[model samples]
Target chain A: MEKRVTFRGWMLPLLLILPQVVISAVFFFYPAGQAIWQSLFIQDPFGLSARFVGIDNFTFLLSDPFYRASFVTTAVFSVLVTLCSMVPALFLAVLADRLIKGSGVYRTLLIWPYAVAPAVAGVLWLFMFNTRVGIISWYLGTLGYDWNYVLNGGEAMGLVVVASSWGRISYNFLFFFAALQAVPRSVIEAAAIDGARFWRRFFTIVLPLLSPTTFFLLVVNVVYAFFETFGVIHTITAGGPQQSTTILVYKVYADGFVGQDLGSSSAQSVILLLVVGLLTVIQFKFIEKRVHY
Target chain B: MRKSLIGALLASATVLSPLAAYAETEVQFWHAFTGRLGELVKAQVEEFNNSQSDYVVVESHKGNYSETLNAGIAGFRAREQPHILMVFEVGTATMMSAKGATKPVYEVMAESGATFDPNAYIGSVKGYYTSTDGEMLSLPFNSSTPVLWVNRDAFEAAGVDPDTDLSTWQKVGETLTALKAGGEECPLVTAWQSWIHLENFSAYHDVPFASKHNGFAGLDTELMLNGEAQVKHLSAMGEWARDGKFIYTGRRNEGGANFRSGECALFTESSAGYAGIKAEAEFDFDVRPLPYWDGVGNAPQNTIIGGASLWVLEGHDAEEYKGVGEFLAYLSSSDVQAKWHQDTGYLPITAEAGEATRAAGFYDENPGTDIAVIQMTAKEPTANSKGLRLGSFDQIRGIIDEELEAIWAGDKSAQEAMDSAKERGDTLLRRFETANN
Candidate 1:
């Protein structure tokens, strides 16, 4: 029999969720609504007055080749960051789970990067890969690689992806490590007794069991790559080397703040909001079906 | 009884404090300066505050240039704008077009009965922040122009004459080739790539960077940067880049680090790099006027300014305006301006300030320090030489940077890059025109 607690009244339950509702309303819904409303109008920088232009801003953005290019860039960046951050994290977490000695030290060392700010991570990688003075760049030059991210679009994109993913690995590692530890010992022991090789046992049992955690991380990492990598891009590249790394969020910031184009920026934001919403729905509808739990 | 006595004392203190505060009008000044520059601004504010009892000028450091401009705009939206806001040269057009948002400096001076003369300022510096009628719109403060910064030690090590004249681009190119042949790693690097390389390069060559008098005459101007001279100069630079004679550092003075570290033989950067180079460089260095292409038409016209100016935001109280006026006058005084110019390496906006600095033998003491000022004041500015006043210029600069990077990377020809830059930048200009006009 299933058991559940019943609230004394709807009032109590509503009161219990009031703070969250108010927070979402004020912080998320209101600003999002305002952006949508502002997307339909053009205003001067001073905010003295505005003129409504219906869907003109949207039409202009849709017709802009640069804006369309940013969408493709954002897609590529998101996929690369998610894979780079998650694959290394999963590998490290598995190694950490198997460790019997000094595991605490190794885990602590692995988790240390999570504390670094994204911008700081970007600067750290930039110092290592800087064209003039970077040690890595100098080493690469000696190897005849000639690393110059400032002029090379591919190198710039790769640098930002690595820097952004470097900080996220620790977060993903924590979750994967915890999930790996939670796997039932008896199941693995039974598999070992059945003469199954370690790799086969892990693939058949532990991997399938970890699907739920992996799915959760996938959604989270995608959102992070989309929204939270702005600092890394701003510091490392400023979306440069020929706009090759100008992701959607960075373009929104560059257009709105630097260009001071409120209408176009707002329209871009509205489009981003819709893209995120559709992505979230698709994730739940398609990707979540693969999760074991 | 103790609580009641404390409450009574607090009430009396509050009543007396208001009366004391009411005696002086407070003026808020927001600036985008940090580090040594920040300290100098603080000192200036302290001097102004100490000079008067009726008005107190409170100064705040508000991030870098772009961030500070955004802050001022956001504050204005919230109706909490500062009395005086420091806006960089790129923001001049946006500030000028925001009707009823700012009080013209000339009007502020006249209304406050402060002794004012627009002619007291240097024409090149003042023209950047003036109206079409030659009225001063903003107070020119901390103006800087781009110049050639050479590391003498690097040149000497490269077997090139340390005192070789880099007056023309041909000479600069030969020197760069010599430096590269002598095993120098970085022959030339630049800061503010578009500002120094393209915009000022155009002005110094008496060529228009944009149509309609570089956008000063009207709002419907388009980018005119893809001219034959510009293409020629950029193609040469691109070839030099391919030969490893020119190093492409990250945009916006990331090259300054390499230059100041004595790794680069020649650096084209702002004159304001003086303060940083002075503090950081271990080798001998000197400033020279920006090099121009000899083949360009009547080359080496006056270079334009790049630093920031002070605009008076509207909606402040009358007394606050008076305090702001008095503070501007104090800031523009010859003693203050000369000291600021000498200490910060920014141009003396006023002619008297330049004279005072010269009389004090500052220019004699610091050789090449006057190159920026002399380069700027060499000739009365032509229509093409006066600073650009286009809307969405900052964004256009970003576009230009991207295109220039493509050129340096050998991914696109100079002609193709500049043509694309003009087309893309013109769209933003049209958007700006539709929005503002």
Candidate 2:
């Protein structure tokens, strides 16, 4: 039998859902509609006048080699951030789950990084890895290694990726820890009594049980890396060293705010919106099937 | 009834006080100066405010250059723009392209009956902000030119003579090689790499950085930065980077710290760096005219300005425009300009100010302080050296910076990088043309 909460009338249901519908319309639909409208016109910075360009912005963006290059950059960056953040978070969550004492202390300490803003986190990393005066780079220099991220695109990417993922690990850790605790201890003990080793039990029983949380985190972290890591990239590198770290969202910000090319930026944002929508749909359609609950 | 009457009386009093004090017109000025420079601007505002009672100029710091420009644009959209907006040199084209949004300073000065003289300003500094028809569009402020700064202590320590002539890139290179052999960790470092190296290099070598007379002739212009002189200069710098004779610190002023901390032996930076270098640097230093390539003909031409200017926006009242005119007149006055020039390391925008400072022996008190003004006014700037007026220059500089970084990393040759920058930058120019035209 299916369980449902039934309303007395359609009016009641509509009234109950009215707040969310109003919010989505105002915040999401309104701006999205405006962006689509604005993307069709080119205007000066002052917006006193506008010319109807009619898809020229989109056509230009699609044909530009730099915009296409940023797509691959965004993919690589998001994947790296998600993996680097989640894998360590899962390991720490598992270790904390096995702890008998001081788990609260460890958990509280692990949550500290999540409180730091991305821009501040970026500054912290930038200071330590500064090519000229940074302590870490200086130490590396003393160790007979010349560490110059200012010129080296590979090193610049590595530093930003690490900085972007650092704060995210705590966020992932919090959710994973809660899920690990909610996993029934009796089932794990039963498996242990059946002569399954720690690793074997974790792989066969605990892993499958945590799949729902993992899937949710996968989607959340991918979105986080795509949109929210902009502060890290902007503060660390202003998308330089040959545009190696110029992700799609950063391009939107640079063009819209810095470059003041609003038409192109709005078009880029519209494309980014569609890409995110498609990704979410794909995740729900294919990846959600593997979720245990 | 008594309480309501008291509330109504208090509201009336609040409204009446503003009416009494509202006799003075307030002129809002937004700028992008901070630190020592910010303090000077505040002092200037307070002085102007104290000088007269007709207009009260309220100045606000609105973040850095790009942020302030964006804020001004956003304000215009919201119909709340300041009376005046200070834009950096590169933002010249963007401001010019916004045809109806800005009210030219010449029109303001003329309509308000304020004392105005276009010839008062230094030619090169004025040329950058002037329209094609020879009208002053903005009030030039805090203009600076790049110059070579030598750490004399480092030079003496390296057994190289501190007084060696570094008028040419060949000599600078030789000096850098010696500084490197002296075990100097940072032989040479630069701030604003594209401005100091490429843009100034082209102008100083008397080569066209862009066609259409550096965008002064028409809106349709293409970059000529990949020409022979620019590439040869960059190639030399690339070789120096590869040999570890030069350090690539950053795109902006991150190299400033390196230079100020006495880690760098030679710095190519704006003359405005003097104020900071004066206070922070413990060792002896000297400023020299920017070096030019020896191979280029008629080299060592005048370099371009790198600082900002104040532009008046439209939609302001005539009373406010009159105040704007007076405030600008006060700012460009000889005494005020000379004092500003003496206090900070910026070039005096007016010839009278430059003369007043010299007459006051400020330049004598500080040796090498006049090099920037001398370098900039060395000759009548030819078409090549009058400074760039390219549209979408802020983004184009990003492309130039990326390509320059590639050369520093040895990922691409100077020729390849400059060619790539030209191609990328031209696309932005075309877009800017389409939007503006």
For each candidate, the DockQ is: 0.79, 0.76
What does candidate 2's lDDT look like per residue over A8-97, in tens digits? 869988998999999999999999998999899987777867899999999999999989999998898889999999999999999998
Q: Rate the local accuracy (lDDT) of all candidates.
A: 0.91, 0.90
Residue B384 CA error for candidate 2 (Å)?
0.8
Q: Can you give the TM-score per candidate against the true fold? A: 0.95, 0.96
> Interface RMSD for each candidate model?
0.9, 1.1
Across residues B1-437, which tens digit of lDDT does each residue of candidate 1 receive?
13344235433544553223546886778899999999999889877777778886767777889988988898788677889999999999999999899999998999898877778899998888989998899999989999999999998998999999899999999999898998899999999989988999899899889999999998999999999889989999999999999899877888999998898989999999998998999999988889999979668889999999999999988888998999998888888889999998999889999899999999899988899999999898999999999998889999999999999999999999999999999999998888887
Expressed as tens digits, the lDDT of each residue in B296-333 for candidate 2 is: 95797899999899999999789999999999989988
Least accurate 10 contiguous residues by lDDT in model 2 chain B: B1-10
Task: Please name the candidate that would achieve the greatest lDDT relative to the true structure.
Answer: 1
Model 2 misplaced regions, further than 4 Å: B1-22
Q: Write model 1 residue lDDT over A248-285, tens digit each, in one string.
A: 99999999999999999999999998998899899999
Q: Which has the greatest DockQ? A: 1
Docking class of 1: medium
Task: Give the poorly placed runs of model 1, Cα more than 4 Å off.
Answer: B1-23
lDDT of 1: 0.91
